[model samples]
Target: MPPPASSQSCAPAPAPAYRGRFAPSPTGDLHPGSLMAALGSWLLARGAGGEWLVRIEDLDPPREVPGAADRQLAALRAFGLHPDGPVVRQSERGDLYRRALDRLLADGHAFECHCSRADLAATGGIHRRCVATTRRPRPAVRLRVAPDARVAFEDLVRGPQVQDVGATVGDFVLLRADGYWAYQLAVVVDDAAQGITDVVRGADLLDSTGRQILLQRALGLPVTRHAHLPLVTGADGRKLSKSESARPVDPTDPLPALRRAWAALGQDPAALAGADRVTDLLPAARTAFRPQLIGRGDTAS
Candidate 1:
């Protein structure tokens, strides 16, 4: 995060009102890096005078931690980032994803795949030769990315972006072979249903925007504006993630962690010194929010 702007010229564009969301998977407690994402999305939405919603992306039950969703929400409240609408859980929205998948299958946009992770890893994750019909009753479903098909979209912070989905990610999975909806499909459907206008999250997910865009187009749904913030990294130079043993943010005393997240976005935390509580600091932070100060790949160390 950058220093608080001294003049109006350095402020972020209070644009075309937004409906942003902070969707997180409940695999563990709210870690520091995850707090940055939560704060970034919350600030962006509040700054634009728009709605900020919360969605618990618990699609993969195998990875979800029991009671983690409620704990995550509690952490956000400790830092004063509350949602404008009812919180949504992806596990309860299977029917919506199934309906969307049915449409894609009916239109010949989606196909079944029996390839496993190990199988795709060997082929560089392209899955180019998996076109053969499923040998088993249960098979994963994948969206057919046309050869050399260029998917382009403007990222608010990263600028104009382009990617050849077929060459990069190949036929991406929409439904896993294990009877769970893939992140790509569930997120697209939920975002559309929730009327999410902007998506502000960690830069680690920047690459995923392209695939999500492809899904948006295939579903005939409007694509939302995206602004991926710089990721927070551990001392080892890798992203701070749950799987990496990243420490969870302190829920009992969230102020310090909240301040660190504020600074991580390149914002000057000193301005918030007088804010005795987290909720009190948010209004001013929202006003001082400047996404442009966030440089690409400027990971929080």
Candidate 2:
């Protein structure tokens, strides 16, 4: 005999509040490209009357510059882009990631992977399954993306987006071979823990969204809204990255860079014409910001 069905219908859960975040790697000082993303995220959060949080992605110690995280936070404050709560650091949250990884492994949503770069070179670097004949003592952990798995979501800034995760990314990493948590796993766990309702960052990370979404589903976490701002490029038409020695923005004088970033977002230049300080400029910019007006293509810095 089966139990009687409950009278309540299985409706979807209510959406969370408008909580947004700006997460930056502590690789170097805040540069034009990074500042643009920070400002864009701050404006969107302020415009929507939401809380804006900051997180330092310092999981990769080898790549991180000493004191870069503190400098980044200082620069953001100079630009009047203050976070609503205490800043979260990925380095301090390893246990959360470990628990999530354990759950995925227990549920068969993830597996231990022994394959290295050379092993999957023939497959164009996409890991479908374990290809190594010999397993290392410390193998990496990867999510088991099914062959037919597809993720679709509406990007707040880029509009409707879809990605075939299995075919394109195939069994992405959750933990690296060096015993470090991968960005996909750390970000998914932190976002859910922080109750992030929106993720607004540079378009350079747009491709990683699908993997994060899949991880969220596997972990039974809420998927946040995404808005990827256009990437800031250099004269060579390449993305401005901290690793390439992109010029860092001066915190002492932030108006020029702020205005330039505002223009890059396709917002009206006149909107910030009379503003002389960061405080005055940020409110005006927030009031004038229109997400629909942001361009899809990368902008020259």
Candidate 3:
């Protein structure tokens, strides 16, 4: 991902003073990538004098490993990132999501589908799954992806991103066949509900931007700034992810890890040295933070 700024004539659109959140699925512990995201987002919000919040994206129970949320919070604290308010638990917001689904259904922006992955994989993931099913159970909810649906925006870092939501993502799931609320739906609901106006996140989620934009349009949520930083990858060249057994960031000893991560990302960790307190660090980051300090492709930073 290209860095957000150039060293010359910087005219950054003000980082919104609205609330922002770092929502991580409880499928795994926080890792280096997670820390980078937490650091960037936390610093951005706090620097803008806005609320920095955390949300536990734990709506899917089968995929969620127990205690991952606690480990994640501990890791953030170890990194000196303290959230502004109590964490939001997606699992506890089922009624909210269900009500949203009913609203969307009544509004005709979404439809129910009963297609299996094997069934859709045959049609290159675009064919309707419930077209043949006469059942009224409404197995899963999918945004009725318009054939020409394209979402475009200028990312704060990776500028000029344009993606076709219907083609790249197809009629994406808002709810799963297993009765679990999907990530895209839950995330959009939470971000709007929480008043998030800036999204400083990993490049792995770059594609999700198109779908999220669609959700924002359907739900009439405010447009948030998007900054997609390159994701950290393993030695194998694959992007680091929870499913890959990536080593979790140490929640107890965040300094060494943050130091190593800063150096790894090519950012000068010493810039943040001699801080008065943990809370002071974020202000220092946002004030002195130069988005152009690092390049694309992350081992860190």
lDDT of each: 0.81, 0.87, 0.72
What tens digits encode model 3's per-residue C-alpha lDDT throughout 161-280?
889876667788999877888988888776776667888788889889888889878876666778776677776666677336478877665666665555544467777686645555
Error of model 2, residue 36, in angstroms: 1.0
Ranking by lDDT: 2, 1, 3
Q: Model 2: runs farther than 4 Å from truth?
A: 1-16, 242-245
lDDT of 2 at 228: 92
Worst lDDT run of 10 residues, candidate 1, spans: 2-11
- Best candidate according to lDDT: 2
Residue range with the least summed lDDT across 10 consecutive positions in model 3:
2-11
Candidate 3's displacement at residue 108, Å, is 0.9
Summarize candidate 2's per-residue lDDT along 1-301 as a digit string, tens digits. 1112222111222435788899999988899989889988888888888888899999999999999999999999998888888888888777777888889999999999999899999999999888887788999999999987889999988899999998989999999999988999988887887788889999989999999999888888888899999999987778888335369999999999999999988899999999999889988888888878999999887
| By TM-score: ranked, best first | 2, 1, 3
lDDT (10s digit) by residue, model 1, range 13-122: 23346889999999988998899999988888887878998999999888899999999999988888889877888877776788888889999989888877766677
Regions of model 1 farther than 4 Å from truth: 1-16, 117-122, 131-134, 243-245
